[model samples]
Every structure is written in C-alpha cells, then in structure tokens.
Target chain A: SSFQNIVETSYGKGDKVSPFNVATSYNNFYEFGYGKSDPKDRSSSLKTAPWTISVEGEAERTGVFDLDDIINESVLEERIYRLRCVEAWSMVIPWVGVSLASVLKRFQPTSKAKYVYFETLYDPKQMPGQLGGGLDWPYREGLRIDEAMNPLAFLAVGMYGSILPNQNGAPVRLVLPWKYGFKSIKSIVKIRFVETMPETTWSMLAPSEYGFYANVNPSVDHPRWSQQQERRLPGGVLFPNVIETKMFNGYEEEVASLYAGMDLKRFY
Target chain B: MGQYFPDPGKLLMRLSGIWASVFVVAVMAMTLIGKIESLRFVNRYRRFIGLAAFFYSLLHFIIYLILFAGLSWTWIASDLIEKPYIYVGVLALVIMAILAVTSTKPMMRKLGKRWKPLHRFMYLAAIAILAHLWWQVKDDVSLAVYFSILLTPLLISKIPTLPVYKHFFKKI
Candidate 1:
C-alpha cells in the first residue's frame, strides 16, 4: 500500500524509481503464503502468548523459560541499523531489544559450549510453511559462541518502540545485524548451546548456496548475484538504488573482530 | 547459385525454421533445471541460451519504448540519437525481432533466400545483448558467469559443423 503512491507519483520516464527496493521490503515468506502482502495478513493469526522456550543442550540451567521470565527487567533500546538481505536489498530499521548476551548469561554457557543454536516456534498448524518440505521446517539457525556473545547480537523483542508485530517475530527473536536475515531466527522457542554447528534451515536445504556465517559482506558475492551494490528501501523516486554496500553494513568496527582471521568468501 | 539447385536456398530457410523451433523447445525444458542443478550439469539445458537472449532483447526494447521513451515517438527518435548502448541494444533487438517474427514455415517460405542470412544475425545479437548486460552490472560477477554460459555456446554454435553441434543437437 505504501508503494502504490510512490509508484504512481514518482515513477514515469526518467522518474528514477527502482523495482528492486519494492521486491525487498514487500517479501512474502511463502512459508506464510503467496504475494508480498500475505505475510502481513496471515501472520496475525499466529499465537505468541503462553509461549515457552525450551533451553537445553550445553547450558548449566536446562529447563523451559516462560516468555515473561525471558523479558523481565529487560530494557528495550532502539538501535537504528542497516538490514541487508542476501537477495540484494536493504532497509534502515529501528529495532527494539536487549542484548543476546544478557539473555544467555541468565542460563550460563557451560565450558563444552562452542555454538548457540536457536529454533523457531515449529507448529505446522501455525507456520503453514512447516506443512511442506521446502526447508527441514521449524526454521533452525545458529551462531559461533564468540559471535553470539557480541554486543551487536540482540535477543530482539520489539521494533519501532512497540511490541513486535507477529509477522516481524513477536515475543522474541534473534537480531544479528551483521549477518544475513535468516541467521536472525524469528519467533524463537528453543535455545541450545551446542558443541558443533547447528543444521540451519536454508543451509540444510541447499548447503552449497548458504553457509553458517552468512554475513552481509560486499566483497564476497552470493553464488547467484553480486552483494557489492544494494537498493535502499522507500527512497524517493529520483533516488532509490544506493551505490556500494558497506563492510559489516557499516557495523564492521563493532563486529569485525568476531571473524578476525576467517575467510568471508568461504564462510559466506 | 540460383540456377544450380533451382530453390536449394528455400531448403536452407526451412532448415533454419526447424533449428529455431528446436532451440525454443530446448530453452523451455531448461527452465526446470534449478540454479544449483545448473552448476552441477554443464550440459544441463542449452536451450535457455536463446530464450534469455530473447528476454534481454525484449527488455531492452521495453525500456527504450515504455521506460525511457514513454512510447513517445519524438522521445524515441532523440533516445536512439543520443544513447550508444540503447542504439546497440535496439540493433540487437531488431535482429532477434526479425528471427522471432519469421520463425514459421510460411514466413520462412516467403522470405526464402534471405532467411539464412537474416537468422545468422541472431548469433551477433546474442553476443551484443550479453555484452550489454555484462557492462551494465557494476561488480556483480554472478551476472557475468550467467551471461557467459548463455553466450559462449551460442557464439561457438555459429561454427556450423563443429563437434559442439553434437551437444547442441541433443536438445534440453
């Protein structure tokens, strides 16, 4: 709906509108339904209350954490950051959340912990995509122990200062700003501290296409397209595609040390 | 040459039409091969070679007419005058447009002697369009590999009776 006015008024000969940005912000996580608008409509039916996160694996305190216990005394801070997708588009969003380290510290990682694995709430009844075999379903993702400990990594609870919309991962989710969007699993219900890499949904679906460290690096391109440039969302017609993507999406100074000596091309 | 076979040239035109049909079907079948699968099989689906070349040329014309010129006759004349890439793209589009328009038995029969030479222009158009796409992308090497796969064989296929034709004859 927001795009209609932009398209009608700002798009014409030499008007400078880009179709790329429209495709980015208006994504249909077909796991939800079809059309760019389906996620917004069908996602509301998702029940987030009475949620329980099963915290198991290598954590010292292994038990279910109710949604209330997860967010108690949690101060939500609005952090404005650039979200670049693997699909070549980006958005500047103000996310509201407390650090993931704060949440993880509550349980305490055991010495055996080498990675943090998260599982999306897997109700085949609620998440329609779970009904099919596009992914292993339940949408799984993980991060290296050190990467999970970074300050930029947040266990996001809200966005735009209000509680998160269902479509935007209500109740709780991961927000690793430096990595690809998938790494930030939404509607998370399970957190595991594992000794090895977790089988991520997209990576499991196509191991060669996606890797564990799916960071937003301009220098290393996806096998299908270049990540060097990106289309900035909701720009005026005359200016849409912004030239050059920044390293770590301009968060390199904050997150570069996390991957100090690794090869981004192979890791990506 | 005309007196030698008294319409041997018509045979070549009909042959080109058959070749074009075979090319169309092959490209259609190739679409089923997913991106990852395309990487695994070098001979995955060569038919999409001409199909993508067809779309790029179609997009080139649409951009000039709908996006750039706004279908304004006055604007098109000025655009064809000023933009070098647009002019080259239009030339490629014109050649593919002719091949597309005349890719039939009756049209092939009517065009006769001119068909073979006219259709040969498709090879050049494919190269030109690929070059046009390659030059437009800033740093995305993925697009380069994509166009390279489609163009390299189309360019090589121009060598009429080479062993590559053995691979080409086996459609998608």
Candidate 2:
C-alpha cells in the first residue's frame, strides 16, 4: 500500500502477465505447506507487522532494523520480471523494491565478507513446514558478494502494486530474477555476511537435486526430468500452456557474465 | 466445491492422475502378491478400483473443460497436441474406458475365453500411465519416479516361469 510509483516496466514483455488469482494462489512456499496452493490458503495466519531483520556478521554497520526503517531508507522501484520456477513453470510479476546492492552498501560489509546468507523465520507455529523434517529448518539462501551487489539482484517488499502478500513473502524477500524462484527466500528475518559459502536449504536437503547458484540452466536436467521446457501457468487448469525453457530465465544477456568462467553443469 | 477446493480443476487433475496410477498399481497387485491367501481379497474389488480410477480420470477432464477451460475447443486442441503427456493420458483412459464398459457380467460371459486376454489391456494402460507421469512434469519428477518404483515389482511378477524353475521363480 505504501509503494511509490517509479515506472519500471517493459522488462518481461513477451509473455502476458499471469492472471492475479493464479499468481497469488499458485506458489512454492513450503513453509506454508507442501502443496502449491497451500500458501494462499494458510498464510493468512502469518503475523507480519513490526518485523525485524537481524543483520550480523562481517559488516561495520551490523545491527537489527525494523522492516519499516529498511523500507524508508531505500527508494521503491517497480520491475516486472519473468519468474521461472525450477519446476519449469513461469509467471510475470511486477515487484516493488530497491536493489540489494543499495541496502547492503548501507550495512558496510568488511573485507572478509565474501558471501551474503539470508535466513527466514523459523517458528513452527507460524510456518508449518518448520515442523516437517523434509528440509533443515529456518530456510536459508546465499549469494556471492559480487552476485549480491549485482543491480539485477533485488529485495522485493511488495508486488502487483500492493504490499507483499504473506504467501508471497511479506515484509521483505530476495528477488533474484535470473535464478529459480526458490532462491528468493520468503519471510526473511536474518542476513549474515560470511567469508565462506553457506549451504542453502534446498542444496542441503537434496544436494544432487538443488545447487547453490540455482541459475536457471535448461541444459542441466533434474535427475528425474528434463529442464528443456516449462509450463506457463494459469492456462486452462487442465494442462498449463508450454514453452521452451530459456537460459537464465531469459536474462542471459544481463546476468550471464557473472558466471563467465564457471561450469554451470558441475555447479548445478 | 469452489469454496473448499479453491482450484477444483487443478486439484482434480492432480488427484485423478494420481488415482489412475494408484489403480494401475491395484490392477497389478494380485499378480505381485502371488500365492498369498490372506491377500486374495484384492481380486474382488480390482475391477471397481480400476473403474473408479477411470471415472475420476474422466471427471478430471470434464471438470477442467467446464470450469477452467470454459469448454474452449481451441485450448483443448492445443494442449492435447502440444503436451505429449496428455496424449499418453488419453490413450491410458481409452484402455480403461474400454475395459470398464466390457466389465459387466453379461459382457464377460459373452466374451468367455477371450475376456481374460481382453483385460490384459490393463497392463498397457499401466505402462501408459507411467509414461504419462514421466512426461507430465516440466522437471523434478520424484513423484512419478516414486510411482514407477511401486510399479516395477508388479510388472516383473508377470514374467512367465520356466517349467524347471516354476516353483522357485513364479513370483519373480
């Protein structure tokens, strides 16, 4: 509701914006529940006001900040991004937020800081997935310091011209356009600057299946299925419409240079 | 249904597809558990379970067309043509439909000796379901692979035992 109008569109123009009902209702926030639609159904119970982000580790200005303080500090810009899921589905979302680079700069990371690790809230009472043993709890994600500073990397606080939906990651969340959607951890509460790579939740749960980078690489297939195609969601509900998978989720031109020398297949 | 289901068409599609695979497993369960007297009761309901799966599969389609697709013929045509998994699912449903229609007591009596062979089409539907599951997801097919693991033993149990090794290898 407090979102500013900063005019950032014409990014993901090829695909029509996925309808609102489908975009909100269809999601992969396992913390809410296992099913795709569970987040929308169950997340109304989430307590979101007066949230705090505990910023610690390898930063000169390390301290906790209220969600409002962070919002006030950064200028909100609306960017419509094509969100491609690791499951080979996609949607266009108009996200409102500032770049992670601007926010991280205020924290002033030390020379020792090589990576940025994010942590989601861990209460089982609030997030049902914390009760399950499927993943190590308090869902975590990380990025190389350089990747974190990339202008393409974003910290989304809201979407669709409204305050963030609880199911969509209320208060604040990372929104990495080029990576699989899950890399953008939801309901983030802790941010740690680290010298070494932190094992992300998905990567730790199934190392062979999920990788740390998680850049959308169509060539590197998931063990049981091919990643060469994706279903554009909210079609007829019988079968989602299909499309060819794009490298870096159609942002290869913008962010491919970040991985110029590394092998995606091995890292994947 | 709308209030509770939220997305009835999507939910039914997923559930019906899963039921089809489950019943395919049921259709093969007796073959998998050979000579086990306690489990002999499974045969009595095998036809009904298979028919239920077919009914769900058919309802899955009809509900989707009515509620979600608004009976848009063009979208249905595109999905049937573009999604290879849908083609396989249709084939599997066809097998189930034929078997269900002929499952009546009078029809079984009419076919007589040929009925047993005709019902072997269930195996074809089973394999088709597996293929359909494999093709259904864009990636991360752990569920499909899980179903496949359950199916492997049942299919293997159908192998014909040799005369010399009949007793030792019947359930292999």
Candidate 3:
C-alpha cells in the first residue's frame, strides 16, 4: 500500500539514493536469513496486517496499540538518510515516517524512563531464520532517552513513497541514521521505556566487536575489520565506489553533542 | 548463480574459497581412504584434485585482489597490517602455487625422493587455510567448525604411531 500524505523533506537531497531494487534486495534482516538476498527471497511469508505493538515499562498509557492507530496520529514525512552498516557498506534511503519522539511522547513516559528498548517480532513460522541459532531470537535494540528524542531518530513506516517491503522491515522500523544500520531494528513488536540501559542484541552477542553506542566513527575499527572506509552500494567489481567514512556517518554536526564530555573511544 | 547474487564479486569470492577448502580437504581424505582395495583407484586422481584446489585458491586470491581491494597496492598493504588473516590466506595461496608448479611429470621425476618431503608441505598449507577460515570470522563460527570437523581426522591420520591409524590401515 502506498502512503497518502508523505511530505518530502530536504534530508538527503544532494546525496545519490541507492537503486530501489538494490536497496530492497540487499538487506541484513537476519530474521529472514543471513545471506544478503535471503530476506528478499524468504520474507514473503511474513504477515504484516493487523500488527500491534506492545508498549511497556515506565509509560503512563502503556498497552497494546494497533499499528494503524499510531501511524494515523502522526504526519508522515519523507526523510532521505544515509544508512551505514557496521560491515562497511552504505546506502542512501528515503524513509517516510514521523519522529520517534512524537510517537513515544503520546505514551507519556515517566521521569524514570531513561532508555527506550525495541524488539523485532519472533515467530518462527513467519520468520524462518529464527529457527537457526544465528542470534538470540527477538532481535532487540535500544537508545538512551536523549538519543531517542533526537530529531535524527525516526520511526519509519514506509520508504520510497510506499509502505515498506516485507524484507525491508514492513509496517514499522526504526531509522537511526547516525548509528550503524543494525541499530535501526526492523519489524518491531515491543517498545519499553525503562530506567536502566537496555541490552542490545549485537552488543550482547559480541561486546568487543559491537558496542552499544554504534555511532559510525571511522576512528573506531571493529576488532576484525576497518571502519575507516565504506563501499557505497551499486558498486561494481572494477569500480568499487570506496569512499572515506565520515565521523558519525556525516551526522556529527547534529549528533556530536549527544556524546559530549563522554569518552567516545571508551563508549565505542 | 551469478544472476541471483546482488554482489557477484562477493558471491564468487565465497564460492571459490569454499571450493578450494573442499578440494584441499578431499585430497587429505583420499590419502587415508585410498588404503582400501576398492578405493585404492582414487589415489590416481589425487593430483587432479590437488590442482583443482590450487585453481580455486588462485581464483579466490584474484577476486580478493581485484574486486575486494580494487587492485590498490596501498589498500592491500594497509590490510596486511590491519587484518592478520590475510597473511595466513596469502601463505596458503603461495604454498598451493608452488605445489601446482611442481605437479608436472618432469618435475616429479627430477625431484624423486625429495618430492615426497616437499609435497608434505600441503599439510602446512591446509593448516594455514584453516587459520585463515577461523581468524576472519565476525560472528558465526559454524563454517570454520564444520571444516575443522572434516579436517581433524585426516590430520590425526598423519601420525604413524597412533594406534587408531594402525588399526584402520591394518585391514588394507
């Protein structure tokens, strides 16, 4: 289904958006599978209709809320953003959604709500890759309250002027452009506003390799690979389109202050 | 297969790497299994399989150099410093190339007694390839674990004094 009132914004205007076919086909939605094309091939079985998100912990209006109700309340806008994967690949995507802060504020998060946690749906029948032990099921991610409230943090429902493809986290997903792509968890089913720092899936799996603050800093290399550069997608074998990676994925001006005074190297 | 893949370079790299490892492991398996009368004929094809392993490894190396590193010597130089697994992978490739070059009938005849000791370096190449597999893994170790399970028995068979090896070969 296509979106009705998608107000286009000047987020990634000058940047080249990756080919829609390439962007949709190449994905890392591990719930569908590990191979880059697995999600595109295997996610057709996922049922996105009648989806509901369970809002829990430290929020006043906490309960199961229908996805349509949440989307109807917000004014959807197209925000073109650059998505940098921890694996050193990047894509420019035009995502349609409202600010995450707009959605969370409706819940009236209490003073105790210092962090916001998100989880992907966990149905082995629909998401076959969950059958494999690649990760702990129900892939979870989180952000600090301040980060969640950041203008850059978006709760995306659609992309490319339409509802999201099932492989691309159909129905709902987070789009934290400044952080690594994995932090933008897909097919979210739960949102919890908690006081303590929430445990994120990748960080829990390999703490040394993936930090909680997965801000795209070129200076901080993954234990196994360099983060100094990235290959922009639509890249060919001979012409790889390798470019120097920017600090905070070129969003340092917007998000750098969020980590002010804190040791980014240590936090990373 | 190329049509299905979004990044053919990455697909080709993985395919060549996997096939190289498969053939290398098969050569080691053939050495022990060839002891049986019914399977002894398999020993004659060992050189062909060994060559196939070298061919695949060469393809894997070329893909890494051209597609992955974009033929940039500076990038490769920096990669050698940052990623230690590349060192082991290069070592394995170099060993395979030497073995491939010496596999001809004339080289085999000239080397005579020295050939057996020199060819034993294939085992060292196998070790290096295993190290290359395990070291670069980001999260999943399943592929490395599977290859290890396939290789461990063949490696142990090389120990002449082991009672298990003696028992297995006694019937043949």
lDDT of each: 0.63, 0.79, 0.87
Q: Choose the strongest candidate by lDDT.
A: 3
RMSD of 3: 3.1
- Tens-place lDDT digits, model 3, residues B39-68: 899999999999999999999999877776
- Top-down DockQ ranking: 3, 2, 1
Candidate 3 pairs with clashing backbones = none
TM-score per candidate, chains pooled: 0.63, 0.74, 0.92
lDDT of 3 by residue, A1-268 (tens): 7878778788997899887888899999988887888899999999999899999999999999999988763489999999999988888999989999999999999999999999999999999999989699889999999999999999999999989999999889999999999999999999999999999999998898888899999888776667888777767746556778899999998899999998889998
Error of 2 at B57 (Å): 7.7
CAPRI quality band, candidate 1: incorrect
**Colliding residue pairs in candidate 2:** none
DockQ of each: 0.04, 0.12, 0.35
Residue B126, candidate 3: C-alpha displacement in angstroms:
1.6
Estimate candidate 2's alpha-carbon lDDT, on a 0 to 1 scale: 0.79
Worst 10 residues of 1 chain B by lDDT: B1-10
